[model samples]
Target: MAETRTFDVVVLGGGSGGYATALRAAQLGLTVALVEEGKLGGTCLHRGCIPTKALLHAAEVADAARESETFGVRATFDGIDMAALAAYKDGVVAGLYKGLQGLVSARGITLVEGHGKLVSPDTVEVGGERYTGRNVVLATGSYSRTLPGIEIGGRVITSEQALELDYVPRSALVLGGGVIGVEFASVWRSFGADVQVVEALDHLVPAEDLAVSKALERAFRKRGIGFTLGDRFASVAETDSGVRMTLESGKTLDAEVLLVAVGRGPRTAGLGFEEQGVRLDRGFVVVDERLHTGVGNVYATGDIVPGLQLAHRGFAQGIYVAEQIAGLEPAPIDESGIPRVTYSDPEVASVGLTEQAARERFGDDAVETLDYNLAGNGRSKILATQGFVKLVRRKDGPVVGVHLVGARVGELVGEAQLIVNWEAHPEDVAALVHAHPTQNEALGEAHLALAGKPLHAHN
Candidate 1:
């Protein structure tokens, strides 16, 4: 005889999406049980987003100290204590994890710590305990993917190890110049590392607009960071002093460390989706418009599902699924409404379509763009930032996109997302008064220019 724990909802993985689902479901008066093999808050809170951002902030502070002379202050610093920095980062992540645990507990969600796999359509096995649920949600999250023969080790590292390193290396090579790669490269470059970015693509951040990619290339070049765009890494060999990576371009880059920032993949293996008849698509758990799989009463969300792999996006999806289960007609999630932000020195953010994509879909004449340089803005001038705000609109339709590249531009993503999701027109925003000399004013001015009413900007 075995003990059977039953619930209205059983969320597997307990990561951002799972925990959020459990909490929201519990709040909706449904009994929820969350099963997790690792820590409660998942990668974003423990290892991925939270810790990496904190370490990057520390690197940014060190860089700021070096530039203090420009502000008429002589700010000197000793070398960065990597161990102490790791401890501080750990404390920050731990505190957030505690807070998440408190929330889950307060919501009356049962926390089950163990590895879980689907036993049946509405049943999961955790630590040899079979639990049945009225509904099941999968939120296993993802892991760092590496290239073949590129094993992660002491010198050959991934972003995971890069975050826990004892000290910043003097020289390093970052493989993959995507969001994560550029972010770490920016951090190391600011910390005085001779950082080189090896991107197989022809440009950095290949997903962004060509103009934005060129802007970052120019910005990195001005800052002395090296780039080997359109080059691929053949292999990594460790030497007595450091590690060396042979590039497909017949060149070898030697550095104290090599950080692999290729990308992440869903944690779908060994979870028994195949055995349970839960459909999968290209290694990710497949879900329909309702986020339900073939398995009756079973659902999935977050990185495991086939969509954008953002923590906030995962949060929204989880809450929506819970509300839907509670018989609430929560509006379907629009993936385009999710904003993407790269926290490099000059952050890049985009919501909705790109200029090229918009033109292709709506024809050349139907698409309009307003590129407003940051130098003309009072807020950017105060920070000495170089970049612009780009507004993309259909000639006769609503505004469709907002792309940005500049200092602190990531903060503008909230408004950009709202405009894109709400289908707000340029005139709609331009008509509204924006506070003067603020970063948001730059957006408003760009919108005004797009609406054919140029104000405080060159036409």
Candidate 2:
């Protein structure tokens, strides 16, 4: 016999978007049900962002141990206990999981642990139970995509296994040059593993402005990270001792472990979207500007929405959709307002239009830019991190974009996002008081230089 249930909102996939929506909706006095087969906190807390970053931080520690001499400090790292690392990762994950559960429970949100599939436009079937809601949010999230010829084995793996690796391999072949792949490469290389990255794109972090791409390549080269960019994967095969890969150029590379991190695909398979007539294209949920699926009362958000597979982006989408359903004043997501950060040794964070993008949109003469090197910045020198603060602007108004690469620069993106989205003029930012001796002060100085008021920098 089929069971039945009802709620004001049903959120499928208890990831960032789903849980956030359920909590917020319940906060608004709406009855909500959040369904998931696995533990909460989704991939970000489980195998993706959170765990991967934990491992990366471990790698950074390993690098710091090796470089303690530079700071006139003595330190030595004997070895990495896989058990200890995994336990540390698990602790971080468990703490967040507990917090999420508390949040959901305190709000009186019902959480059903089962694999949910849509039976109708507004209904989901899980554990033989039928749950219907006025608004259905499908935030199924995404999975890492592998090449057709490549099969992920114990030795050849994706980010999922890389997070839970039993032992760090002596050598690793990272098969993509995207954000995730490069990050892992940096981690592995820092951990004293031989790491090589291969990418089909012409430059690493290829989606960034070309100069940004070139700058990263230079920084990566300085760190001794080997790469084969502008090369396509021919095939992957398992050897008796290791894994081997051949590029389209007929060049071959071998390593004890192979990681495929090209990109991730929407988790839209066999979730009953087809029977419900939900639209999908290129493995992503098809949606209009409002994020509505073809089926009535069925909507999707986050990685499933198809642009910029970011957890925070999904956070915005979930809030917007819930507001739209509740007849509240809702604003469409400004996609460019979403900040992006690459967690590498030299981190990359950017928001809004790139210099070229601003130029193309507003014209060459309309766009002016100031490239401020971190060499002159006090904080960058103190942290031993090198990069630049790029300020993009129009002659008479708004700072268009800010791109950064350095240690902990991701934290500064909040200010950049505000400048870009609020349409704050360069002078407006420049005239504002920024705390002395901070990396963010560089942003203010860059703005001042762009606005024809030079302070702490020569233009």
Candidate 3:
């Protein structure tokens, strides 16, 4: 016996993208059903973003306490208490999960709990029951990806396992130098682990602008975090104590654990997506700029949509899809308008085009860039951190990109994104006074130089 239900909207895989779409659709007065095989809030809230960030904060606290002597504060740099730290991380996740659960309940959106498979364009099957809707949203998120012949077990683990470890190892070898890799490397190094990062790319966070990559590498080196760039993995052999890894560069390293911080792959298998006529490219649901799928009355959003695979990007895409389905005629999302951040030590944040990207698109002579050192920033100087803000603008037009690196610079990307998205000229931003003695003033200083009025910076 199977149950049958109908709704104005149905969202599959209640992750960041799916839940957001369902919530927005319900707010638009559409009856919505949100299906989930696991708990709500998805990876970002549950495992990926929230938990990892908690670890980073704990690491930062440890670093701050260790360096308190420099600040004239009398404090001892005690070692980490793994149990208490884990509990704190879990507490943060639990609190956010509770809030999200309450929000879903309050919205009156039907929360169906089970694995859902798209049986048709507008219908999903879960637990032998059929759920039909006028429109369907596919938001199945992503999973931790590993390379060929790389077995993840025992001492070899992914970020998921790394988060749950009750004890920190004496040494750790992190693979991949992207967001997840560098972040975990930073955390373990702070926790007193002998950390070594193996990145196949030429630099850590290779996707970021070259200058940002160089700065992060320098900071990581100063922290004594060793890394081998432009090298590929050859093999891994497990021993009683730990694992032995050999690189293609003839280098061998051993560690108590190998944290595979490689990227994530979309979780779009066995859900009957393509069988239902939904277009898919290499496991990602194919959708147009407006998020409409090839299948009639069906849409896809989030990590399943072959873009940034970021939670906030999922949030924006989910909202856009919901409004589009409601016939609201919302603007199509510009993927470039989305912001990115790497929450490692000396964080990296950016929005809009890179200087190289701008030069390619707008020509080298037509693009101007300014790099404002954090040494001139009172807040950064007080924090005893080093980095810079790099801004890219059209020769005689608007600001097109903003890149920042240093402590707490991730918080400033909000204003950076606004400048890029709003197409404001350098003078437009320079005219607005940022409060003095703040790291945000570093951004203002970059714009001032770009606007021909160098302030607190060498012209």
The TM-scores, one per candidate, come to 0.97, 0.97, 0.98
Better of 1 and 3 by lDDT: 3
Local accuracy of candidate 1 as per-residue lDDT tens digits, 68-166:
787688998666877888888999998999999899888888888989998888888987798889999999999988999798998988888888777
Q: Name the candidate, 2 or 3, with the larger TM-score value.
A: 3
The predicted structure with the larger TM-score, 1 or 3, is 3
Q: What local lDDT does model 2 show for residue 298?
A: 83
Among these predictions, the greatest TM-score belongs to 3
What's the distance in Å from true for residue 149, model 3?
1.1
Q: What RMSD value applies to candidate 2?
A: 1.4
Give all candidates' CA lDDT scores: 0.88, 0.87, 0.92
The top-ranked prediction according to lDDT is: 3
Query: Once model 3 is optimally superposed onto the true structure by TM-score, how far is the C-alpha of residue 289 displaced, in angstroms?
Result: 0.4
Candidate 3 Cα misplacement greater than 4 A, ranges: none
The TM-score of predicted model 1 comes to 0.97
